[model samples]
Target: MRARVHVLVKRALSVVLSLTLLATINFSAHITSAEAKTRKPTIAEINEAKKKEAEKKAAADKAKAQLNAASNQLKVLTAKAVAARNRYLQELKKLEIATKKAEIARKKEEAANKKSNAAQVAVVSSKNHIGKVAANAYIMGSGFTDFDSILHADGPQDLMDRLSTLDAVGENNSSILLRLKVAEESARLAKIEAEEARVEAVAARKEQADATARVAAAKKEADQARAAQEVEVKKLQQMQDKLIAELLSARKKRVTLEQQRQLAILEEALAARAEQTDVKAKVWPVNGIGFSKGRTTIRSTESIRTNAVAFAKKQVIARKPYVWGNEGPNSFDCSGLVYAAYRSAGLGYPEWDRVNSRIYYSWTKRIPLNELQPGDLLYYSYKADISTIHHITIYAGNGMMWEAHNTRKGLLYSSIYSIPGLIPFGGRV
Candidate 1:
């Protein structure tokens, strides 16, 4: 019995040893896997990373190219829209002038017809009077020829009176004939005048109709062009948004790889550029009219100008929305914002209130680009002419500008030099 128990105990110990060896083997395998995961990547893996980076860069380049193409397309469309709108306005003016001419022609036609009718009536009346005179003369022809007045006379005075009446009737009949002749000529001339007036009225009406049609067609074209431009603008905005997202992603990755000190300097520069402060009584870095020693020489206009700039900057900081033709506390267009800012600053353009960018262009005095000062009105034209000026913004100091840029950008501060279609001159209100 003792020998059997010893063999069984040895078998149990062998089983326990087998279990311990298996646990050691599993722990060693886990350690090997952990070390493999923590090890640096191989050259092949580094090459794969580089390939991915190159692919991302290629995608970025392609997107940038697409953005540029879309921006150019937008410029073309904007020009088309502006031209269509101008054509429509011109047609409206022509329509107004034609309508006035038609009205005048209509009045002239009425007056001419009335005069012609009166002259014709006179001609008929004169003919009837002549007929009555001829009938009386025929009825009394034999009696009058046989010395009837002398035969019917009672005394010398009576005979003389009868003879005078006879002579007066003869003269009266002759005068009626002459008047009738004159009336006939007058009626004929009046008829010609009436016909000429009728022709003029008809022509004026035709011109008015043609003008109306042109105005309608012009308005339709303008609407279509505006709609197309709006659609392109939306598409351009989407592309820009996507590009910004991709840029942000790439920037985040770069920031992760860049040194901490370098990142700090970059952030600092960005922050400094974005900083806004009051300019009241401060030395502005400007040289031009009303400026002396980097300070405003004219205090009378200085306060007003600075106030306008302040008002515009406040809206920009508030991120006001851009709305076409809007002048408000909520939203504004480029010219609307400028008008409102100046109006709020007590430098109101009463005569030119709510006018377009072109009108604003005329209201300002030209200053060279190098002499730009804060609160100066900046103008831009696609055709580089005053008549085609389409955009206006207030100049903020340090080469920056405040503008209600567009639907996609809203009210924002931007580098004046970087924008497209910049005129080399600015305006001082």
Candidate 2:
């Protein structure tokens, strides 16, 4: 019984030492993580991204303004074109009236010339007939000679009277022939004047015809001009439509890019949060009094092992300076501290040798964070802008965590909110 009691006492002492060690290491780790999170990004990078986003939005707005201006201009142009077309139509109507007047003037002049020509022809024919009648009458009067009349007379006195009468008749025939010749000359002169009038009328008619043709040509040209204007108006309308479509497409593209960027940012924030929550749920194995190293412990009949390799690293890097790029002993980066902590928890540490790695696995799919059992790997990001597993802390239940961080603070206990930008993501060994 003495031997058994001694053995029990020794085991209890061992348990106490183990529990104290685990608690000390855990506390130190939390302090380190909290300190590392305090380090921040340079102001230049932040300002540059903000400026870029602002410039893009401003450009989009300017394009929208330009599009509106173009649409207004198009409307103005359309109105002007419509007014011009109406004016052209009015002018065309005037030209048509002028053309009709010119044609009527031409026809009247031609008819006057035709009537003058007919009058001249009739006068010429009358003169010719009068001359011929005078010649025939003169011939008949000459045939009645004075010698025959004297021979056939009964007495000398009767012969004398017959000669006197024959002489008077010859004189009358001569007078009639002279009058007929004069009348023929007058008729011929009238015919010549009529012909001259006819020629003048024909010239006037030709001038009128030429004027009518000119008016027709002018109207045709006006019509052609109106058609050309219509075509130009159509082309301008099509161009305006095309420009509007292009503007709309550009605006749509800009909106889509903005939405995509926002979604990406939100997704990144959620991913960081999930990783930290998983890290928080992880439990280190304790051997009755303290955490055990190099051995599996049973709690609630479930066997568990701390990440022995990670444990060794923490021991090696405790109190290391918080260097941005340092990975080991005398100095540590954010991810380095987290990596070391996980190893100490007896979980198989993934080979996240690079600062940027794609290690997205859902530990909660099998074991939810709300029902977090022991031995889960609670992950986190010190700089949320950094990769998902930039820094980590072990979750001790009740809103407490442990981490190893910068040499300035070493390992310590930390509340969840102690790290300024710490976000929780969860994983399992």
Candidate 3:
């Protein structure tokens, strides 16, 4: 009975395993069917969606540009206002110096007037003293009767003393008068100088006051200008923010779709790997060449040689530096480099060089980045210049990209993140 039970258990386990296997197969088949139904979008759907997205992006870009222009204008106005304010302040400083000088001059003038009046009084007193000394000399001479007789009768010492006394008296009177005259002249000159200084100081003060008023007026104007500019900037910012939000929403939707597509592709790859018994060597569609090369060659040729050369060229230029306007030899501008490299290959590039040209419609729509093998076209947009695609690069796999950039750094390979404003679009050749 133990052996019978063991056999029964083994049978039950086998049945369970079989059922499990069958269920797994059925589930896998169902998944496969669902996947098949949800395959990549058809060309028409892609084109339509792309068109819609392009329209929305265009609108967003226009709004952004307007906002940027307004911002720039506001900056210019602000600078002007600042300059005006500085000029007014400078005038005010000059005015202040002038006012101080005027006050000093007035004080000096008052002092000079006082000195002049004292000097005048001294001059008058000196003249009166001289008159009194002359009268006394006359009276003394009269008392001597005859001047010659008195001279002869007197001793030589007496005559000498008399002459000496007369000389002393005359000298004292002359010295006092001379001193008084000098003082009076000095005072007069001082007064004149003081008055001139006072006038100059007054003028300076007036100028200073004017300057101060001007500065105040300028400040008021500057303030008004700043306020106006702020209002304009705020309005512009609002518009820009609204447009950016819309752009972000659209980008999010696109990202969602892209994620879904990537997930689906990953599922398919896993399924294929599971079913395959033998691992096959993975082959690149365009050997030795990259997406950039194909894009470059496609501009000039439709031949197979063009495609091959483009591929080789891209591989060779994959490590080139990026230059804003560089077209060859190690650097490149976005579209120019892309066109040049593809032209080297046999693939025909878009007829128009501009990003917004009608020829890009098909390319932008049907190509998804994950579906890109080799020789896919890459588009890049500048967030600053959203109206046009400013750059293009070839995908070099391994998270590397090659492009011709500005003059500063010619053709070069750069991480996508290194570019501040780059928005990427992947498309097939």
Candidate 4:
């Protein structure tokens, strides 16, 4: 009975195992049918998908390229904006000079008018005095005419006395006439001077207007450049904030580098100056020749003047403050400093002559850059044009100059290249 029960159990197990195998086969067949329905991609289809991916990457690269171009454009625009601002500042300086010139002309005209009025008064007074003398002679009938003096003689002695009296009267009349003539001549010269001053005043006013217009134009250009730069900055920022920040940082670095270069130039100039002999006169170089230091054993008149000018400059170098239009003992401007130096050297206009940089530039005899000497004037211009000259300083030999640079900088002993807009030629007074 146990064997029969075991065989029956084994047969039941066998039947269960066969059914499990059949169910596994049916599940495999369903999986294979599903895989068959989901077919592998074709070569053409794969290539098409890859092409779409490449196009997507290319579009992304194109956008990146455009953004980079915009970044560069932003940098260029910022540079242009800075340049435009510099130009505007230069124009403003010109306007200030023109306005000052107009003011000077007006003052001169007023003074000339006053002189003319005084001259006219003198002329009238002289005429009235002469008329009074003639009227007194006619009314008193005391030798009023030569014919009367000859006719009213009583004796030889009386005739001689009458003739002497007529001679005295004639001398008085001649003196009065001479005074009237001098007064009239003075009035004529005064009128001429007044007219000339009036014409100068008119011309100065017109120049002021022209300068103002140029300033306006420069300001407009600066404004436009600033607006364009701002717009570019905004666009760049919107595209990528990091990129614009980097661009700005780069610009700042360049500026810092430029400042460093300027400082280096100053240092080099100082070093050169130190190597030079203090008491010796420097023979200025012209075309790479004659840059020698001469001893004071023999000094020419020109050398003495140069020394005086240099001394004057040294007296105010760091001692005086920079004032916008000042030209004096305690403070100075750029042109004012040079003016004061030359005046001290007895080579410039009077103390009351407060001319601007443009006037000073006009008075200069332009010499080559290599021919600059001590006491020579250094003129600076905007865009290297003589017409836009705005600053003046004195060359202090050895590639150095003395200037009342600005309010913040005050007076400085600086290198020739320390300032911007240096012209290739220097001015000889």
**What TM-score against the true fold does each predicted structure earn?**
0.41, 0.30, 0.42, 0.39
* Order by lDDT, highest first: 1, 4, 3, 2
- lDDT for predicted candidate 4 compared with the true structure: 0.60
The C-alpha stretches of model 2 lying farther than 4 A from their native spots are 1-47, 59-78, 140-429
* Model 3: per-residue Cα lDDT at residue 326: 49
Per-candidate clashes come to 0, 40, 40, 0
Candidate 2 lands at a TM-score of: 0.30
- Evaluate all candidate structures by whole-model CA lDDT and list the values in order: 0.64, 0.47, 0.55, 0.60
Task: Sort the predicted structures by TM-score, highest score first.
Answer: 3, 1, 4, 2
Least accurate stretch of 10 residues (summed lDDT) in model 3? Answer: 279-288
Candidates 1 and 2 compared: the better one by lDDT is 1
Worst lDDT run of 10 residues, candidate 1, spans: 279-288
**Cα deviation of 378 in candidate 4 (Å)?**
84
lDDT of 3: 0.55
Candidate 2 has its poorest 10 consecutive residues by lDDT at 286-295
Q: Of the candidates shown, which would achieve the greatest lDDT relative to the real structure? A: 1
Residues 1-429, candidate 3, lDDT per residue (tens digit)?
234323533555676546534544443343233322224544455455566667778887887787788778778778878888788878867766776777778778888888898898898899889877767656866443236434655787877776676567768977998899898898989988997897777777777777678777877887887788789778878877877777777765664565445444644554444344111111111111122222322322235334633553453435566555545555555665655655566344445443431244234333433343344544544321224345566654323355555657665544322343232235545
Q: Which is the leading candidate under TM-score?
A: 3
The deviation in Å at residue 85 for candidate 1 is 3.2
lDDT of 4 by residue, 17-68 (tens): 4653454344323322221111334455545555555555555555567767
